[model samples]
Target chain A: MNIAVVGLGIIGGSFCKAIKKYTDHRVIGINRTKSTAEKALKEGAIDEIGTHESLENADLIILSMYPQAVVDYVSRYGEYIKKGAVVTDVSGIKRAICPQMTELSEKFGFVFAGSHPMAGKETNGFDVSDADLYKNASYIIVPCNAGDSVVNMLSDFAKSIGFGTVKITTPEEHDRMIAFTSQLPHVLACSYVLSPCCPNHKGFSAGSYRDVSRVANINSTLWSELFLENKDPLISELDILIENITKIKDAIKAEDTDALKALLEKGREVKQALGE
Target chain B: MNIAVVGLGIIGGSFCKAIKKYTDHRVIGINRTKSTAEKALKEGAIDEIGTHESLENADLIILSMYPQAVVDYVSRYGEYIKKGAVVTDVSGIKRAICPQMTELSEKFGFVFAGSHPMAGKETNGFDVSDADLYKNASYIIVPCNAGDSVVNMLSDFAKSIGFGTVKITTPEEHDRMIAFTSQLPHVLACSYVLSPCCPNHKGFSAGSYRDVSRVANINSTLWSELFLENKDPLISELDILIENITKIKDAIKAEDTDALKALLEKGREVKQALGE
Candidate 1:
């Protein structure tokens, strides 16, 4: 397969390198910034670094840009992609971009599906990108009218790069699931980090404290955008998490050890079931 | 100092190894079960394995028993401990035990201060003990009676085991701090793990999920005792955590991006301030 990756940042650069390492597919990278594209190619992330014009004949096209850029770019350049070629993305929130992607695919006679690889680092960008980033990670695949052939191709492409793809029911489901799994937790971590007693009382941090706050030091601008984009579902999940914690707090307040134990036991069971 | 660790469980065994590795002290292992005591000795966790009689000659006595066991064993054996010997502990909670420890010390001709080395693993017992457990971990030192030679000796012992010790103002302060930093987080993790969606979802589990749930698969029996013992402060911290989480949840439900952003920012600032 000939793969064209737009946006040569952390996810895109890593995808390019992974394709080169794990498959016979030839990867071409297209970044809005020429320097980043050049760096990706020079770092062996891709077989070639090219301008957007080079996207014309690719077997697969991936929009690895920010959620907003992906929506804008796919809408504008959907026609440049080859007819019947598989097109997907690495956006965080699927619902926000999936509709635009579907419309773009339909208008351009191409196949568009949205994908979210559940992997990243606190520090990002091309410099920290590696081929092994998705070695054991999940990639949520949301296909809407992209056709069965295109979905299969995208799934094959994702599997070839070492991802366990979950065929999500809809973009809404994908977004909501991720809201619970990723977004809410990040929000919680960030809040815990900024709490008054933390950085100020440096001497008191333990392993749990460190682990809970590991993702606190994040790219605030990017995260802020994501939180805004996926606001609806993320909020719902946050509410559920808060409700669960509130139940625990009330039980603790009553000194109800039995209730607290039951709550903790439930969590343990859930985590064990998830095999986490 | 000649130190006697009066329990050969996970923490005690690891303590013995860490002290031996970093200090010149003579380490003694005491356990109700003779075979376990012998095992700790044979494993080099102790220079000697003996009875409560060993406490008579020791310059320092490290109480490495369970939370409830500490009060019980100390109350009965308080008569055997040596004059002017410094007594300390490695229990998870401080407030519940420190007052009793102070009272016991007064009657036994010894000084009782408390400490908690913030390092451990999910697995228990002597078999999994390692001397490097405390390296790079914070050790919270709670000294009693306005601090004295005993406090200095306890601090030295904590430092000897590769920990940076911080002096806690009082037992209540120590308990409240740990409840937030340690206990509440554990409850959250345990709850997340027990949630239905998490069970059998390992393939979708990322570093974030793993980070949060790593400590969930803990020894629940031991945790139950700790929770019950430190019920007061644990309950207080649980309320704060619940409130924080619930506040975020409400913002999410109302689709309030500003509120969500503020909460996320709070966590991020707290974590980053810790220099993680």
Candidate 2:
């Protein structure tokens, strides 16, 4: 199989490396910056540097760019993509991208499935990409209009490249869950670190501080775009988080030990139930 | 030196194991549960089970129980502790324990210094305690009228137990910093998992979710006591966090991308400055 990976950033470069390391698939790397594609080629992460003409030969096309960039890339290169080819994306949010990609796939006679690999590092770019980035991570497949065969193909491919699980859901469900699990945590981390006390946390901190503030070192430009694109869901999650925090704060302020204990116990129960 | 560790929970048990692994001190284990002390002795983590009579021969006494328990124990056994012995605690909160321990030291003639080991796992109990639990973790010392020599002795002891750094500060400063670094993160994590969406986060979550919610699996009873004991400082930190989250929420709700970007950028800057 010939796999064309567009945008040689962290996600794309990692996908290229994983495919090269795990399977016989020929990977063609494409990037806005030719240097990143050249670097991946030099490292043997990809078989060749891809041009728009290469889309006609690709069995699978993975778009690994920002949310809007994924949509825009498909629109600009739709005509060049071969019929029956599978096209997927590694976007964090899907509501805005899935529907449009489905429409474009129908028009172009290709298969469009929105995928999000639930894994990442704090750093970005091809420099830090790893073949094991997707190892034991969940791979979410939002079958926009793609059939069962397309979904299964993507799932099998993900598993071959070390994904532990493949979850099938709709784009709406994906956005809603991502809002709580991903975007909201980022917001909390960012806000948690903005406190006046953050600068002085050197000697006094431990695991709790490290965990809460770990995601605060973020890609601000990319995240701001994602936050605005999924505005309603992200905002809703943020409001709930803020309200929940206020309840705990109020309990502490009133010195209501019972109330505070109950709240903490509830959280512990929820976490224990997850059995992670 | 003769060392008496008056508790056999996670912290106390770990201290015993660390001392046995890294030093030649004779460790005496004490616990409300006699079985736990026997187990520590059987495991060779401690040399003997401690009694009130044993306290008189000890050169160092470590109170590794809850904040109030530490106070109550010192008050109950102050007369038995040997003169010139260095006494310390491993409680999370300091403001409430430090001054009380200092006065008890004056009355009993044993040197008292409040200490907090800045490392822990989500699980507890002696069974899970490890000798290297303090490896590369911070050890905070609140010098509650203990002179430089006593402070130095405690600092050296912590380093011998694998602590990477020893931080010395006043009880008030320790409490203020801990409110933000440790207590507030627990509050945030607890409140975060309380969301209606947590149970459904199995496949939808990744590192951000795991990091932010990790501490939610807390010892509720222990944390509630710590939170209430350091109520003012924790509440102040919580309020600031709430306000900061609100500002970000307002920007996202208003679709003010520039404002959202700037807020995220500030968080990134702070995290980068920490260089962790």
Candidate 3:
């Protein structure tokens, strides 16, 4: 199978590297930056640097661009993709992206399966990409009716690339789960670093402070794009968290130790209940 | 020098072990539970099991009990502590305990310099204590006129016990700094783990989820006491964080991608500005 990975950034680059390492797939690269493509080729992440013409022969195309770029890419190149070719993505949000890609695939006589690889780093680009980046991480598949062959192909691809689990759900479910599990943490970490008390962190910070704010050091521009694209579900997740936080905050404000303990106990119970 | 460590919990146990390992102080341990004290003695964390009479001859006394227990113990035992002896504690909050301790020390003619070791694990008690726990961590001292001698004494003690740094600050300042770095994070983690979406985390959680929620598996009973004892500063810190998160939440609600991106960028900047 010939797999073309678009955008040669961390996610796309990783896909190419893993496919090249684990399978006999003909990995082709399509990056906007010629330099990035050259780097991927030099690193042997891809067999060839692909042009728009390469979309016509790709058995599978993986879109690793940010969500907006993805919409734009499909709009521009959907007509050129080979009939019955499978298209997929590594975007964080899925509700907004999956349906549009699925529709475009139908009009263009191809398959579109939306994927959210629950793996990445603060660093970006092809140079830092690793075949094992997705190791022990979850890979979510949003059903876009790309057929069993395509779903199985992508599942195998994900597992071969080190995804610990690949589960299927609706695009909305993907966004919802990610909002609480992934997006919400990023938002919380970013906000946590901006806390007024952070200026005094020099001699004070320890494990919890470091742990809570570690993700605050993020790719701002990329995250900004991701946050805005998944607005609704992300908003709901934030509101739920804010409400929970406010409850505990109120207990502290009122010096209600009993209430505070109860709130924390509830929180403990919730975290404990996870994975059980 | 004779050193008495009250409470054979993790912190005090570690202190005793380190002092025994690195200094010539004759370490004595005071504990509410005789078994814990016996365990400390058997583990060689302390040279002797201490009684109320031990304070009469000790050159220094270190309280490692919880905040309320420290207050109660000091009030009960202040008269027994030898005049001119310096005392310190390893309590998490200071404003409530430090002032009371300072006043008690003044009344008793003993010096009280509040101390907080910025180190601990999620687990507690003497059985898990290690001499190296403070080797790379900060120690804050709230000086209460033990004079230069007492400050030097405590500073040397902290360093001798493998603390990375020891700095002096007012009790108010210590509480304020900790509100942001320590207390606020506990509150947020406890609260964050309580989000309505947490029940769905079985196969969805990843790195960020684990990072931010790590402290959600907490010592809630102890933390509730800490949170309420330093309620004012903690509440103020919580408010600041809520306001910041709300700004981002509002941007999401408005579907204002630019504003959301800008908020995230600001958060990224704050995190980046740390240590640079």
- Using TM-score as the measure, the top candidate is 2
Cα-based lDDT at residue A45, candidate 2: 100
Q: How far is B246's C-alpha from truth in model 1 (Å)? A: 3.6
How would you class the docking of model 2? high
> What does candidate 3's lDDT look like per residue over B1-276, in tens digits?
999999888899999999999888999899989999998899888999989878988889999988988989989988999998888889888888877888898889898888999988766789878999999799998886667878988898889889999878887888888888888778877777777777777567787888777777677788989988888888888888899999988887887778877788877788778842
**Model 3 residue B23 distance off true place after TM-score fit, in angstroms:** 5.3
- lDDT digits (tens) for residues A1-276 of candidate 1: 788999888898889989988999989999888888888778788888877677786988888888988878877777688888888888888778877778878888888888888888876788988899988788777887777776777777788888865555578767666666677667767656544455444566567776777787776656767877887777666666667777776776676778877777777666555454
Q: Candidate 3: where are CA atoms >4 Å away?
A: A19-26, B17-26, B41-44
| CAPRI-style quality class for the chain A–B interface of candidate 3 | medium
Candidate 2 lDDT over B108-146, as tens digits, reads 998888999999988899998999999999999988888
Quote model 3's TM-score. Answer: 0.91
Off by over 4 Å in 2: none
Ranked by DockQ, the better of candidates 1 and 2 is 2
Q: What lDDT tens digits, residue by residue, belong to model 2 across residues A1-276?
A: 999999988899999999999999999998989888899999999999998889999999999999999888889989999999999999999998988898999999999999999999888999999999999999999998889999999999999999999999988899999999999989988998988889999988988999899889999999999999899998888888888888888888889999989999999999999995
Give the lDDT of residue B73 in candidate 3: 92
Higher-TM-score candidate of 1 and 2: 2
